[model samples]
Target chain A: MELFTLIDILWMIFFLSLMIGCGVLFYRLGRRSESDFFLAGRGLPWWLPAASVYATHTATDTPMWVTGVIYRYGMRGIWYTFFSAWCAISAFVSTRIFRRSLAYTQAEWQSLRFGGLGSELLRGWMAGWQIFMNMFILGWVGMAMGKLCNYAFGWPLWIGLMGFSCACAVYVLAAGYWGVVVADFQQGIIALAVIIITSVWGIIAAGGPGAIVSKLALMGESWRVNPFAFTGIFGGEFPFAWFITMMVISIIGGFGMGTSIDWYVEAQRIQSAKTVRDASYSIWAGTALVLVRNSLWAVAILGFYVMFPNIPSQAEYELGWFRIGFEYLPVGMVGFFFAAVLAIHLSTISTHLNLGAMYATRDIYHHYINPRASERRLVWVGRISTAILLLGSFVYGLMMEEITKWLIFALWIMAAGVWLPNILQVMWWRFNAWGYLSSWIANLGLSWLVVWVLPAFGLIPDLPDYLQFWALMVLGALIYVPVTFLTPPEKMDRLVKYYVMSRPLGWWGPVRKEAEWRGLLHMKGED
Target chain B: MAWIRRHWTPEEADEWQKEDWIAIILSTFSYIALTIGVALSLLMLAVGFIVLILGIGLSVLLFFVIDPKLKAVSSGYEKKQKEYLEGLERVQRWEE
Candidate 1:
């Protein structure tokens, strides 16, 4: 069969038209100012950001990643991917705090929280790091999109990367965050539709869910049906013990210890909401969308399991999502499936492009080079920055040989790298720039030692991924705490102001008392 | 010139001008409730495609009734933002 028949081609064209139309409709919404470009002028209603947050996260690789895990680990495997869900617990609390802080970017929050050369250094370092990280993530997702196209339709990887890159860049450049938000809402719905239909189709094709369960029963792996089949932490993805610890840290840090904390979430959607209440709702909305998205994939996996019950190796299991789509889906339905896949890719890449441009243009370029630059000039610079990010990701995507390895890199290394600093920056008032900088630097070195160097030399006997992750987090702490005490604390004036604005509940006891004494706050728990 | 610049103006207050407390409580709860309802219904359906009838029935019920009630609860605050000021005043007794 031809990869896409005429009807499928028509569906693809229709899908592309909607995406472009979404961009054009919102073209005027972000033209006037930097706020418009970065945060949709901070006038967005709750639902828009809510949809965008959920939409950007459900990228092309999300279903593939979900399927790969299920095929290997059964139902319990979802906990590995559902780590992002932990953010919702934190989101419920931070929305009030993030909206109140009013810092445009998370990097901008440093100067709001700290002062003197320490604040300056922290701010600059974080801005640069965020820009790099955003591009790196864009490249990561870009490569995944390329792999999907190559695997499903026999397209060359580089062409797939470049083609999608240009399409996303054009829409992103057309309207800034406005375009990104509108496109996300539309694309999120379309992608959700595709999943709903395909998942149901897959179920029907497999003789329904009963047949799937019966087949698994015959294989003597009935345990696969249960979601809580938590076999053991020692063997699976993240040793059970370490996974619990990580969850504790994630939840504690996300919600902030005791008081509400923002954790400098890179989600621009949160900051774009019209009110703190709106921001809070957006997180819940996003989390709900994600959970449903996963459940839909679960239904499809039931069909997938029925089709291929025994796999020779992990490679085939990971390719389960692709094989099911290519082999089982009906002719025109297959085209819509690919369109959905492309929709997923485009939505994610567009958000990253807009966010990266916001950081590069607002936080770095205009902040340092031309503090007084016109809104028009900054908008133009934003467009240019989006183009640079697009090309940069395309080049990086071409070079990446596999998506699974990068998955490990993102989950284990990057999570550990930011884990301590993100929590400490909010919880510990004494954690100065030196400490923050040291923690990240230490995390990088220690993570490298555990993840790469030790294993390569055969000195550590090739540790599991979870053990490597635990070592990085523990060692990161051992390095950063002493560094914090060694360095002087952030200046007092900065602390007092930030305390009054955020009313952050933490070790800021002294500062909180001071604010109370001065009547800057009427009473405790006012937030 | 240094590579760092502070865009966060200290002179400008970061105090978020809050929406009416009635609006916030109304909006947040409605979404949470509706979401949970939908999730449970879907879970029922996913247990077996045979139960998809139950799933479809529940989803339709949620869409027709639960979803609209949430809208009414939420938009009631927005539409009646002024009339609800007394409720907002009581909420402000506790909140910022």
Candidate 2:
């Protein structure tokens, strides 16, 4: 193991110690109640939680991946910004509904609205999938951290993986939700600062925006205009249909996946807000933060391309960002940049750990293993479960070497398995528990089957991975709709009360007599 | 009710403004401009592999000179934004 420079080593130690200190401080501060541990006592100001949510979601992989997308597709990656914009707006609109209901989890809402074995079954399955999705996300965080450590300190992948994961586990287990929130706020600021500095520096390094555009124009109009260009397996060499399919899958399927319960940190923040208006404002504020934060990273990646015209291929995009940071950044700025990277890794990893532990302790253990368990015992379980999940993630990180592709695959799986069923059940009351179960199983099963069987059968085209993902998603959704309708609808009363509260637009059943008698009738065309 | 409506406090106005779609729109546009400028630059450089391959020697020399200037300009804008927001806060305090 080659020893790092004194400057590098000291910088690393400083960040590591700071992270550990923050974790310890948060742990002591939040050890009072399960509510404090899990939800930060539900008293965090909108800005803090909103910032935390943005920071937690803005992973280190994001900039690098965005860079890769810009490198490969040019202008086409801009579409993703639009999609995210829509998702943000949608999230903002949904916050009012979520705030009014005041359910702890999306699954709880399902249960309250639609009681019986079906609701229970749906809740159990959704909870299980959430854990699985979180595990996958945690793995990606570990892998990204490992790559950064390898780049910065020449640490072995396993060492970096363990060091990062363990630190996150310690902080999250100790501080609980409060630690994650506070750390997220701090990290979010650091990440934003670093992104601004790096992107500006990168753009200047590349000879300014005008020069960069000129260079792109020279490469080929396709490179400048076509998003699908350079998207195929081996460059711009893939078939057209493949690219089309990938675009559809990533953009459209992404919307459904965005609505998943685990992905709703904004909703969590909104729900935790002090009042309805505060919650709504928090969502908008959070949306703004995400937009700004993501844009900053996007700029840096774009600037790097301009600076280093011979950008790394798509597979190496994430590593390329780190490489650029290491090679191009000024001497003192390197420390700051590395600090931001560490912040990104810690903020995301700790949030995942906290969330995963919530799933295990509240959704699983509290509900299934020991409903009568004391708050103290449940908190202990949360901490232990967080540590266990971190360890598992570290191990998974070791198994996986690449960060970007791993994240995309994990996201695809989540979109198909978790997001699809959960959204359908929530929005479409006609969707029964059996339908939910079957849809989830079929989606995952089909996605896996496509991955395994298509190549063997030569049915898989030499298209972009995104296209393949899109095709699979369409296939999966098509399969799900039929399966959903085939199954019986959930009984009325279990979900009727939720309908009354949420007033979600759809055919939910005849309005309750109580609603009619109390002059709460929605009217004929109210829906 | 008339007095409340006519002599509405500035704090109330600011609160209402936070909810205004106009603020969100302006913020979103600002975000978009920033994203486009950065994303386009990277896309150009990454896809312009042929130029890079041909002028590797020249590009290397050019990059060292260019990168720092970009950082300076970009950081300047950020600093301005920070100052502007701080100024707004001060003005609000003075008004109160």
Candidate 3:
């Protein structure tokens, strides 16, 4: 692996210091209140946090993952991110609703949606799972960065990854989400620059884009340029029917995302906005930026195939991005590329650290340990939680060899069970806590049987990701539908308040009618 | 048809949103322009300097031109959820 020169080292130092400077600035500007740190005191302008959202989504593994997909399935591989785009679709409509929900974290939402012991149980359960999910994501991405640094600069993996994790934790602890959002805005700009430049540079290195196309053509690939070209149209890895089915499911998931009471992970931005309109605008704006990001990475991957057609180790093709970064980029640009990587990693990791900490401090501490904790104490607890998450994720990262291997299982299979409940929670009135709880439990147990054990042991035939996703989504709906109908409906008063606030379009006709009768609504009824 | 309007207070109706046309036109064009620009830039990558300069220009436009327009167009959804929170707090107080 190539090493960083003194200039490269200096540039990296400058990059880190700029981030620290942001932390200092935010700390000074912030009022030291919990709301200011966690949600920018609810006064952020639209574009700032919009850019921050886009920046946070641009993770270290994103480019590497895109490159690997393109290499395997051609440029049409971008269709994979369509799953997340559904969230954007829902967020566009739901921004006002999510912001209006006034939930500090998703867990705190249960009490607002349901009543009594059931709401408490649901709140606590959701909190624990959400924290676990966040920690797992942090570890997976941390390991990717660790492996990347080790390869690029030969720094000890633990030192580079764990060391940087500490820096991010400190940055976050300094000013909370203010630092996270500010640093994210700065990082977003640099990261975008590096992505575009490196993409252009890589294509140039590969004898220009036209020549790269010619080389790829000679390699006899048909659908690298056209995104619509699915090999599944014929007998390929992905079938057309399966693609359509998953898309339908994702469209449904979009409704769930839009309707779901909590989005605490991204809720800070939603809450931080000066107006609901701005928060909504932020979602679409961030999506456009994301499109630009994906395009840059796609071009780089397309160029990579032509330049290094026959790297010895085919299995390690995911690291093909390293070849482009080290071999193709000029001296200073290479350093900038590394800085850009750190920028993306920092943006994503910091969000998880801050978000996870907020969930833990608010849900775990405030609910269980100290019901009347002071704001100052809560802020300190938030810091401690962030530090603890960083340490736990670092240890988890050390244990993993490759994050890519687990991703398919994690996103589709492991998380798929929640996909339906997450969707149903917003739309259906009858989905009680027991129904909600059973859906997840059934989903977990079903996924293990359908996607993992049976397929692995050859009891059942192995299926592709789309098939597994479709199966679990259908099975999850079936379980939850029955469970919801069988379980008692949520109390009328609780449901009526939820309907008026969130005002989502779904099976909340009864609640809306009641809200109307009670004179709770200020204007005409909405779906 | 918009949910915001359905629940809008009489006071809120007086608040006319000015031409969101800038955010509308700019974002649409930027999405298309940026996409087409990157495609052409990659094709024109043999002449790397040209694309790099174009890219720098586009990034500048992104921050300066596109961002402010979008920010100006809308900012109305802030209090939609607050009423719910207050209502829920009242319920809790009554239960206590």
Candidate 4:
């Protein structure tokens, strides 16, 4: 019989208690109004929101995914890190503009920018799509967490998933924004600590970096050099073009299009800041953290190659960092490491729950179901919606087998249907409400049709995934632009108001007269 | 516009607080130190892998592990700030 030591048991108890205690503390802090519950009363400091954004955006799958790429292609995996860093840089550059635009969601921006039936239709479509995509991504995150937990502790899949979901739901539902902010700050620290420890442990276990690399060199040149030398006719080791494209998409268009609104947690952070400059600084801080954190992961994955040269077929896509931690790290350190993973899962799930509820309650329920609903009723509806979304994600996690595949599919859908039209509207002045609606419908329809027809008839040519993504992006934009120009434009007055107030950078000219007429313009020291 | 008048204020004092200089200095130093420590460890690990492959000694890995202790201080500072923030929020809520 294997006997567990008192130290091991104590370590487990300490972290477990810490996790539960933190959840309860935030829950109490968040029990005020719905705003406090959903957005932490919009009073979080720049650093807290910044840390939360960084931690939540980079999930558990990140390290493993990067390791898998390195395992297959070698130095090329750095491209993914590069592109993701670029996305953070872009966010920093655009934070000021986004902060000035005070709409709660991108859908709200559509209504504010383009009024009438055209705006309503666009808002309704976007709300529905956002809810679907948000739920789908949450499910993927849950599945990855479940797999990690199952491997680490030998727990059942459902048990691990339910544990994460319930914890997330409890904190999010209780305090809304406040709980999420507090928990995110703690979780972010834990995540950094765990990743750093795991990397060090892995390096030590291999006897040293020198020994690990020597072993790899002895094994084969392929292991040491070009990891992606396997690309050929029948799907070689790594499709470089596809990999590069995905990385580019993740960095550039990923956050460029207002699809970032899918991240309600970030929006809450923006809302929390005391001023536009404060909000922008928070984004900058968050982006800086992500850049540093992702780079660490990239290095860690490369280290994995030196440590474990020949990954088995089944464990190819498994998180090498988690596997190494469980196998090599000390018993006490193991508990803290697992707690970090739990932090990643819980933060993402709770953020999604809050965001999904916001979309359903603010965009759909209040707009459609009960336009005159009281704040109390709206908050109740939000809680109910959050509970339901959590349950659905939990179930989806159970049903899904391959988490990476699920995430890729979700990203494709978001890139095509959600991102394409949203980017057009933000960057192009001629993109009208009718054009947004048409682009959205056309993108969804065409993507669905392509998925069905290509696979069914075996006509899906051997092409990289990014090729398909690029095709969709280009085609969606082409259709959206022409259709928008052909259709009657939205009311000029409303456009002028939104453009001036939001100060969005686009083709629109400054509406000085409109600003004065609306009594929005102010002279220095007038007050 | 009505909502704007109610929420927006021209008073600079009410709109903004003095930058939290202590918090900024502490956080920035902690971040820089932690980042450098991580980078050095990564570099050491890489060097160790090369040495082992070339039949060199395993002494470098020890250096990698020892340096991480320096990071503990930074982590302590972060924990302190987190606690301070939580306490401030609680006190504010109670007063309200």
- TM-score of B chain for each model? 0.30, 0.28, 0.41, 0.25
**Candidate 4: stretches off by over 4 Å:** A1-6, A26-29, A81-83, A86-93, A212-255, A259-265, A314-317, A402-407, A417-420, A448-460, A510-527, B1-41, B44-96
Interface RMSD of 2: 16.9
lDDT (C-alpha) at residue A493 in model 1:
70
lDDT by residue for model 3 (B1-96), tens = 231123334223312222222323333444444543554465554433354455446445434433333333232333344555466445433333
Ranking by TM-score: 3, 1, 4, 2
- In CAPRI terms, model 3 is classed as incorrect
Deviation (Å) of A96 in candidate 1: 2.5
lDDT of 2 at A111: 54
Evaluate model 2: give its TM-score: 0.75
- CA error at residue A367 for candidate 1, angstroms: 1.5
Residue-level lDDT of model 3, residues A447-526, one tens digit each, is 88888789988997887766776677788888878877887899997888677666665677788678878987544434
**Predicted complex 3: DockQ:** 0.22
In Å, residue A278's CA in model 3 sits off its true spot by 1.6
Q: Which consecutive 10 residues in model 2 chain A have the weakest lDDT in total?
A: A249-258
Q: Which parts of model 1 have CA positions greater than 4 angstroms off?
A: A233-239, A256-266, A313-315, A402-411, A455-461, A524-527, B1-96
> Candidate 1 lDDT, tens digit per residue, A1-527?
27789888888888888897788677787788887888887778888887787778888778878888777766656555555444444454455555556667776666677666776677677777667666777777887777777776778777777788688777789899998889888888888888788777777777776777677788888767665566485765535675566445544455441111113333577778865557656766676577667766765775687788777776567667666676778877777887788788888888888888887886788766777677899899999988888878876676666654765564466576557677677767787878877877787788878888888998887876556666777888888889889888877777777776554534777776777788775554454
User: For model 4, how does the per-residue alpha-carbon lDDT over A58-77 read when each residue is reduced to its tens digit?
Assistant: 67676676667556666445
Leading candidate by TM-score: 3
Candidates 2 and 3: which is better by lDDT? 3
- Ordered by DockQ, highest first, the candidates read 3, 4, 2, 1
Give interface RMSD (Å), model 3.
5.6
lDDT score for residue A323 of model 4: 73
What's the DockQ for every one of the candidates?
0.04, 0.05, 0.22, 0.06
